[model samples]
Target: MTCLKADLLILAGVICLSLVQRGKTKTPARVMALVMTVLMVAVAFIAVPISSMNTLTAAQDITAKLNPNKLDAEIEKIAEIKPVLLFSPKCPACKEVTEALAKLDPKGEKWQPVQSSGEAQEGVKYLKEKGYAGEVSYHRYAGGVPVLIIKQNGKITTIYGKENIIKAVTAPAK
Candidate 1:
């Protein structure tokens, strides 16, 4: 995406410069054009890549979220027996978990994120990408949400599918 943006910027600069060179007469106009062109070039080279990376990292959290060990270590911070739902607003199956969670924790006591509000979606996508979503006996999940996890006694249990999710959420934490 950054490369595309930079190529577009370069193409635009070439077209605009051609027009300016053909039409302009004054040295002052030429100098101003040079200044503007330099600024634009700088922006294309420096700002575009940085912004693109920031956008991807912030939206997907892909690189940082792929490690299951890291994910487990973080989940260990929450209560001994609480439901952690990996949800993305876009996922259809996540809706059921959300509803179940609402009932399971009326005061929102038993549920939390893999990390936070939007990061869980990114984590779920990471899990799907690596084929870790449904490889285990307990997890029959395959590239879908919500992935309901319960951390109890330093153990992480992963659950998938609507039926499993209903059971995971409603089951009392031991």
Candidate 2:
């Protein structure tokens, strides 16, 4: 039933086995049993959410920095020219793309960041404080972070991600 109770039961069983085997007077069996029990407990913890707390915390930190309202306007602006958008967060590859776009005539103004999670009010507040005025759309991608879509006329055209996002965003009209 409960995890603590289960762990205690398992630990008790291991201790009992260790003691019973020790009654005959051997040392190797006792050591092996202790090691096995420790390993089992370790595996149990690794297979659970406790091990993933760091990753979840990092994701939340990243999500906290996004301005959703600005994202909405960036999407609208991009849609006026193209139809799809490729985007990624503040990773090195995405930064490379941003740098490449910066070299273009009009740069950072065309891109937007979409936070994949967190409270909508916080996101809106962030955008307002940043003075970002745009039509924002809050939606998740199929299996990744939220992607901003820019539609030209009625067709989807630009997509943004960690890789090649700059090239996709800055390419000539097609």
Candidate 3:
């Protein structure tokens, strides 16, 4: 049944019950009806596609179908690098990391920190969107921002924030 119809029926039921109860059940029934109305409104609003809102959405819709194998493989290849920096401009922790990375490197060898459009999915979406062919690291340890993520053979490790970046830099390579 349509949600609008169902909500209407529920509202009618609540009103009728309140009338029968002579206002004794007025508060409870009215509350239930209000809850139901809000739920219905939420469902309707959430049902609309965020395509218009999501700037990351496809710019042009391609009508022709294409194979995803070549694309996925290439993306996986790039994502398999030992460690990659994922950061967004919106994160303060990322700002700290960026500053440290800038100062820590003389030859630009500390780590390559790439600026992502935003940090959603730890900024992995930016990598894939830009045609990176490897897996996106999703390690939960300090996963928010300024993360040094290493992915190899299905294993993911993460070191979070600026302090860790300094430690990794000062430590000898393994």
Backbone clashes (count) for model 3: 8
Clashes of 1: 0
* Every model: Cα RMSD to truth: 13.3, 13.1, 15.0
Q: Order of candidates by lDDT, top first?
A: 1, 3, 2
The per-residue C-alpha lDDT of model 2 at residue 66 equals 45
lDDT of 1 by residue, 4-90 (tens): 566667667765765566444555555766676777678666543445455433333432344323444444454254676666544
Off by over 4 Å in 1: 1-72, 79-81, 113-144
lDDT of 2: 0.48
The runs of at least 3 residues in candidate 2 whose Cα sits more than 4 Å from the true structure, single-residue gaps closed, are 1-115, 128-131, 140-142, 146-160
Clashes of each: 0, 23, 8
lDDT of each: 0.51, 0.48, 0.51
lDDT of 2 by residue, 39-99 (tens): 7678666444353456444433344354322334554664675433333333334334434
Judge candidate 3 at residue 115 and give its lDDT: 51
Top model number, TM-score: 1
For candidate 3, write residues 89-108 as lDDT tens digits. Answer: 55666666655655555233
Candidate 3 CA-lDDT value: 0.51
TM-score of 1: 0.40
